[model samples]
Target: MTQLTDTHLYREIHEQPAVLRRLLDKEEATAAALADLIHGRAIDHVVIAARGTSDNAGRYAQYVLGAMNGLSVGLAAPSLFSIYHRPPRFGNALVLGISQSGQSPDIVGVLAEARRQGALTAVLTNRPASPLADQGDVVIDLQAGEERAVAATKTYTAELAAIALISAALSDSAEQRQALAAMPDAVAATLSMNDAIAAAAPRYRYMSRCVVAGRGYNYATAFETALKLKEMTYTIVEPYSSADFLHGPLAMIETGFPVMIIAPAGVMAAEMAEFAHAVRGRQAEVIAISDAAEVLATARVPLRLPAPVPEWLSPITAIVPGQLLAMHLAHARDYDIDAPRGIHKVTETV
Candidate 1:
């Protein structure tokens, strides 16, 4: 039985598929215009600046831009300009500032300076009229209206859609767009598993800490899911790429410690399956989000994807179940689903 208690986060999560479709239908022209600017200026490098949830979106942007356009992508350290007052050369770069509220002082500071340094600056924000949007040479609205929840469900997916749209436009690949067209349907199917995920919540009700792992394009999913768990459930969660996990963090797993793995069917699936088997060998609880039968079989608790989604577009769909797990786990533990401690809708840091 699905929990009947209604929360802002729960409502927003259900609203994502509609919001994503609207973005695809409406943002086609805007995405093309941004692509034109990229080509016209001959951007050689890409730099993205964001904070909190938006930074996770920026991480997805890094992977998409690198894989699709073959451009060098780097995440900006806002403190370099906001705190130290040092400006690096970005004359031939495309700098993107991502903020859901478009009100973050430091993110705007980085974009303002990037523009001053002769870089082509763009912003992906829900607010088109905000100061951060004003800093953009071009502004791509997320089209996620008035997100009432503090934890950010619709807005985060909106950011991923916007970034994926930009990447597809830059490449001018109809095949990529065709692949992306499957996302809304995939997301819808994922939402149908909410009841199942909620039922599985008790398995992690006592979970105090965990590791979220992924690789390649879904690496950002790992980071974002861990962020959601920490923010809403107050769990001490660490996120890592599968390779990074092997380096040192693998030692942290004790007997029966919860380990959440996002291993969608992709080139990285086999590698992730191997890691999952190894974790199970350590007696840690393996909670896997995957569509691969082999990976699913290796897990103690399986939260399956609806279909075999393409690797390039997996992050947008794969993260939905993770978000549901975090929300359900928090609710199961009696935490406030709408408001977590010491956090606000818009975080302003300088």
Candidate 2:
């Protein structure tokens, strides 16, 4: 059985705060350039193309851009362009491609097609020289440096911060900018919980399967956390929106089953509290990651956030403890935290 080590994955998780700070300090000019480029075009809508962890970031973008910026954002289906050879009309749209490596053929193809179709194309990637960078009219480097771990840690949060910065730049809102600026500190604060999260990992060491749930902005965190557990610990974790869980998935809960909930404070707080009550009635173990007192009260074991973050900004800070949970769970289960079976840093998919 493998024990915990100073793995690259662990290092990358701790490096997130520095990665975010580097992105803001060094990439300010690049973000400004993107703002200018976006302003020059008449963007009537938004379409983001990504896969895996980047796709989770895109999901957050869809919510933030639509709710805060008043622009309808859609997640692009690259298969439509790559496989069917039928590219949607993206004219007068802001088409953004997000990738950690910037090497996905389908993602790059979609952005290239969007650019040819007269849409304003932009790219967010850690690699500046990758193919996707060339496809975009404006490329914003993630500045997360090199991510050596197969299950992305720093790169994922960097994408979230990059999206937030882009949104702030687009709106020229001082409040939004301030929120984005404070995120690094928030993440740094959350990292201090590594000892606590690691101490609690033994409780779920034998967890073979579970459900991860969240809503509103933190819904993306639910998906990403489930993905991390799957990738690292080989856990069969299913993620759902709390509202959607009540539809059918709720029936899966049994007495002693585990249900991990990301319940940050905001508009979704009350609904999450209600879900917690329902889970309690089922006799399932509700492990909640939240800053809300109500949510903490309902959880069997609560991993509280370091600060009370608003829903819009919660994704950035809320994800840290979950990421740590995945790492600690992997270590507890005696799995290699740096490299999972049958996965790589860059997944090539068409």
Candidate 3:
């Protein structure tokens, strides 16, 4: 049996802090430059084109850019461009493409069309020279280096960081910059909980399916966490906003059913605590990833995030526990931590 520590996934999971620090150091200027270009343009909204984990990052951007920068943000439907050959007008929009490898044809095509229409375009990718990058007027390098794991660990967080950095740059808020600077430390602190997460993983070794819940910015965290669990442990995990879960999906919960809640301290805290209680009342086994005392108290397994992280930035640190949980759960189930059964590192869809 290969040691989990020897796996690419494990190494990359632990490499996140350094990767974030490197990204901030190297790409802050680029992010600022992109912000400057956006400011110079007549851009009014954002259209993001991505797939898989990158699409989840776009989810985060929808909230962050909309709330922070006052820009309406929408996720682009790449199939419309790549398959149907009918692309929408991107007038007065900042069209952004995000990919780890910058090789997805559909995503690249979206940016190409946006650029051809003279829309302002930007790309967040690890590869600055790949096809997707060629379509961007500005490129924000993720700086996560070469990720060998089929499931993205560092690049996902780096993408979130790049998005946050750009939003902060657009705002030119010193407080936001300070929060961004403190993110590496927050992530490092979150990484410290790995031992506890590892110890708790075996309890869920038989977990065949579950649901992940979050609200606000961590809504993206829930989706990304579900994706990681699905990829690494082959678990049937569904992600939902806390509001959405109550509307219908709450019916899926029975006694001892597993549900992971990503609830950090912020505006969403009270509502998440209420949702935690509601699910607990339904007799579901609550596995909470949160800094809130009430939510943690209600959890059968409380995966604590480092506290005092701003709500807007919480997704970056909150997802760490979920990644660790997936990795450790895969180890418990004796699954391949590096390569999941049916996926590759770069998936180019067109």
Candidate 4:
């Protein structure tokens, strides 16, 4: 029975309120150590590390900070702090470790080493009591609370928001702060599109697999979206560069295999459109998210954002539809969205 309460998948949509409530109290919910670091000042480059969804958020942060404030940002494998990829000695570097649970050995251990080398450290995590906190110079609590869904929906949004706040603080501009402040509403509005996305999910459910592609910020979302679909829907989804897809992956793309492209109206807009034509020749389905005119394709889905934003932050918007897609698919399959198989809220990878 598709009763409202029984729909485990829609719980993701319902949980939207919980995420919004937590975000509103940002200061109260924020981690003291992370806030202190921001106030302490004096930071050079920002370095980040994480494995899955967290890694995508880290990549988003780099784009936000670098494109918005023109700051130098770097992302490292947490193993960089150990032998082989040993941590670089730099007092000015700020290491940012992202782990929802805050206990992953790679993130925690590398953060400890970065601190030892005098690099400022910060964490994006949901667990305040996590040992990873002990190693951080600053800790930005994701405030995503307990994400029961193994596929990860809200935490990804929270972590990205936290990163934007941290980046805006570093940019130290009132304009940036205002932009960051407006994000909660932007996100809330984005989530409101759940119905539209739910309507679109069935169109691709018959397909065995699909692809998500983009460049820069949306590139990371492409990767994250693919990960979410596989984790939540038990479906095969691939993340690739649009250009790279044309060079190779496009060849294997048959009628049933669709392509989900995040075609942002950003720096690479023209090149992106050209790439879309290549996929067209393969007779593959193309679902593009963009503000420009929609292209005709086997399946063209146009995502409409309210207005233009900093190009780096555009992917932040691109991801909302993808999240809704994952949610709808889970519902369609009558699967438990709150607890997907073979995963957990915080995978403290052993």
For all the candidates, what are their Cα RMSDs to the real structure?
1.5, 1.2, 0.8, 3.2
62-173 in candidate 1: lDDT tens per residue? 8889988988889999998888988677769999999999998999999999878878999999999999999999898888889977898899999999999999999999
**TM-score of decoy 2:** 0.97
TM-score of each: 0.98, 0.97, 0.99, 0.86
Model 1, position 73: C-alpha lDDT score: 88
lDDT of 3 by residue, 1-350 (tens): 78988999989989999999999999999999989988988579999999999999999999999999999999999999989998999899999999999998999999999989999999999999999999999999999999999999899999999999999999999999999999998998999999999999999999899999998999999999999999999989999999999999999989999989999988898899999999999999999998989889989998888656999999999999999999999988888889889898989789
Candidate 2 minimal-lDDT segment of 10 residues: 1-10
Off by over 4 Å in 2: 1-5
**Model 3 TM-score relative to the real fold:** 0.99
The deviation in Å at residue 141 for candidate 4 is: 1.5
Cα error, candidate 3, residue 211 (Å): 0.4
Best by lDDT: 3
* Candidate 4 local lDDT, 1-350, one digit each (tens): 35434544456545654664575356333443454564466665787868798899977877777777566887776656554666667567678888888878877877888777877787778886898888876666777666655776677777777777766665566776676556656666666677777788887666568888887777788888898888878888889877777776777877645787776667776667777677767776778776645432323666665545666556666687787788677777776766778876666653
- The runs of at least 3 residues in candidate 4 whose Cα sits more than 4 Å from the true structure, single-residue gaps closed, are 1-9, 12-25, 28-42, 80-91, 294-299, 306-309
**Model 1 local distance difference test score:** 0.89
Q: How would you encode candidate 2's per-residue C-alpha lDDT over 203-223 as one tens digit per residue?
A: 999989999999888889999
In every candidate, how many clashes are there? 0, 0, 0, 1
Candidate models: Cα lDDT each: 0.89, 0.89, 0.93, 0.70
Give candidate 3 regions above 4 Å deviation: none
